[model samples]
Target: MQKLHKLLRMGDLAAFVGIVDDGGFAEAARRRGMSASTLSRSVTRLEEQLKVTLLRRTTRSIEITSEGAAVLAEAREILNRSETLKEIATSGQAPAGPLRVNAPVPFVLHVLAPRLAEFHANYPAIQLSIDMTDTLVDLIGSHADVAIRLGRLQDSEMLHRPIGRTAWKLVAAPDYLDRKGWPEALADLARLEQVRFAAPDHINTLRFIGMADPLEIPASVTANNGEAVRQLVLRGLGVARFSDFMIADDIRAGRLVELFSGQLDAEPLEISALYLTRVSGLRRLGVFLDWLDAIQVG
Candidate 1:
């Protein structure tokens, strides 16, 4: 047991992580700047020391057995904690590691991208990697430090902080309104041409205001992407529901006009930043969260 304990050191933990990340011994060895034979021997030694077969290896490929997967997960957690300790000991000021973030596509390009330069300038030692997608990502599984989510959060395990609110507006281009007239009531929405915002499987619902109840408008044009729906609206195809932040520029330029504004509710969609509560107070994560709060969006 003592020999096994000594063998399962930091280097073995790193090797276990590399195998899971790279998907094979050859790939993991390549990433670690070692030969494939060397990596295989190291893993074999680890299994022997533990007296457990952790991986199922064949001539063509290697797969982590159930035991191996559990071990790998524990190893990753240990490595992360160890690295955090090292950072705490070495760096006394500012964040100085990779910050992985996930955010909705439009928000990243339209909102976060513009402010990144300033963040980079302030924390020059920190490196930022952003994954932009509207799809919901598992923060722990993806190793993401932060995520910017729109609307209400359903994950009770996560820590959520409200950043801002986005109003949902029913808008139409001038030409479309000129042709189809205007929708005066909830019933009018059914009669008018509509463009549906089709989000991915998990995020495929739309909410509206007024009429003593919510209305679910059928789609004349259904798209999986928000940008696609926006383009169709720009072309004067139909009236669509969009976030206020998204159509702010068009409304200001008079390209799009809001319909039935008086009937709509004032509670805008709540936007929040989400992360694992345990890691929310980390130095690097806090720095980025503070930067996000300072941003002013209309």
Candidate 2:
């Protein structure tokens, strides 16, 4: 029988796989928050122990040998099984270890960030790594433990739980509307200056509940981020659509005014937490999801 314990180190296998997945030792080290030399040493040790030339390295790049490709496949399986074992071990234990979370910028700033301090206080052992961006991310490829998504979710094998919803409103600053005059009909929207959310697939139209055709509007200004669009509208630039969570206080304080409330019937954006089923039994994820459920989000 093979001496499994003495055959090779699990950490060395992981490092080799990381080096290949990240495309190089330096990048793997950077993403893993370790030094490049350490990863290089791990791969070197792995190669020596296996008696196989895993990678052919040049000054500029690396080429993986056939042996390396075979080893990589096995290493991925072993590492994944190791993670599943960890999940099983911690299923009933106190919530601990690292949790990677992904969310959009607006939700991160307006909803999640405010509650982070209290969450840390409650579960001091749980480490958090949060990545904030508006663009969608591949959860498994990005190694995210959970992703908080807005709007409709695409069809996927990942499991999701609804967190809450936020109403969308057509809004503008008081001074801007006062200067341009209030819109009397849906047709008036096309004539008004508008601040638009900048995206490649962004539509320059609004779809109402009972409308047959979407109403097209002109974009006076464009911003890639929701917060930037909010700022533009606040500065009396033009009328823009905003989620209630971003401007509820401003609406109540009269800094911004909601327009065509009776006419606009845009559906509320649904908030949800997405994760892989493999991690569904983890206590730390469970604790975090429970906290998300308890918190009130606009």
Candidate 3:
């Protein structure tokens, strides 16, 4: 037991996890505000203690071996267990730690930004690192404790909790509609230029409630970010289909006009909070999820 204690250190395991999570010693050190050499030494010591070559380091990159992957999985479990132990020790105190979250830009701006103050007030000790990107990010690789995803989730090993749903709204700025005549019939969309979402799931065709055939629309501009597309539409550039949570304020304020409001037959996008199954019991995560559940963005 004494030999094992001498060989293994929790700090070393944490450094190893941090190195892999950030993809490089320099990056992990920079993110943690530590020296890269210190992180490199910790990884070396961990490798020596474990008696396996966990990582193959190159000048520009570090590649994880199969053994490294296995170790990383165990390391994450151990770290999460340690965090749980801490929470257990201080049952009455507020949970605290860094909580990294990955989410889309529009959701971050429209939905989360407003409620953040309240969340911070509730858990003031919690440090939040929010990565706002329209593209899908790997939860482990990005080092995100939680990820807010939209649409039908693909097959994943991570655990997910369905938060709510949001439907797409076809909208255009009043000035744009005035300049380009309002689309009366579905066929009129052919003449209109649209600001489209540049995602794999985004389709060029539209399906209406009563229509037998799907209508294909012309895409004049395509952006990966939802906010960018909304901005383009607001500037009288073209028509756009945005999620209801995003356009609710704009529609109410008459900044944008909703076209075919209740006539479209489309599946509502599923909003889910995804996380590693190991960290599901963590108090900090639970608090955030509870807050999310209360908001119910749909």
| lDDT, each prediction | 0.74, 0.81, 0.84
TM-score of each: 0.79, 0.83, 0.93
Q: Model 1, 1-298: lDDT tens per residue? A: 3233345867876776677666678878875689888777778877887778878888767788888877776776677677667666766777787788998877876678777999999999888999888778777545577888887788866787778888778788999877877676667766667786676432224344534555555566877777677789888888777778788778999999988775555456778888763453367877788787788553
How far in Å is the alpha carbon of 173 misplaced in model 3?
0.5
Comparing 1 with 3 on lDDT, the higher-scoring candidate is 3
Checking candidate 1 for backbone clashes, the offending pairs are none
Q: Who wins the lDDT comparison?
A: 3
Instruction: Kindly indicate the candidate among 1 and 2 with the higher TM-score.
Output: 2
Stretches of candidate 1 off by over 4 Å are: 1-6, 9-11, 21-42, 57-63, 184-188, 200-218, 265-267, 277-281, 296-298
| Model 3 vs truth, CA RMSD | 2.2
What candidate 2 gets wrong by more than 4 Å, as runs, is 1-6, 48-77, 84-93, 200-204, 296-298
Q: Write the per-residue lDDT of candidate 2 for residues 1-298, one digit (tens) a residue.
A: 1332257788988888878877788788999999989988998998888888999987767789998888887776677667767878876666788898999898888888888999999999899999988888877556688999988888556688889998888888989878888887777877778888886233335777689987777778998988888899999888887778888888999999888885666778888899864545566888899899899675
Candidate 2 residue pairs that clash: none
Clashing pairs for model 3 are none
Candidate 2 lDDT score relative to the true structure = 0.81
Q: What value does the lDDT take at residue 35 in candidate 2?
A: 99
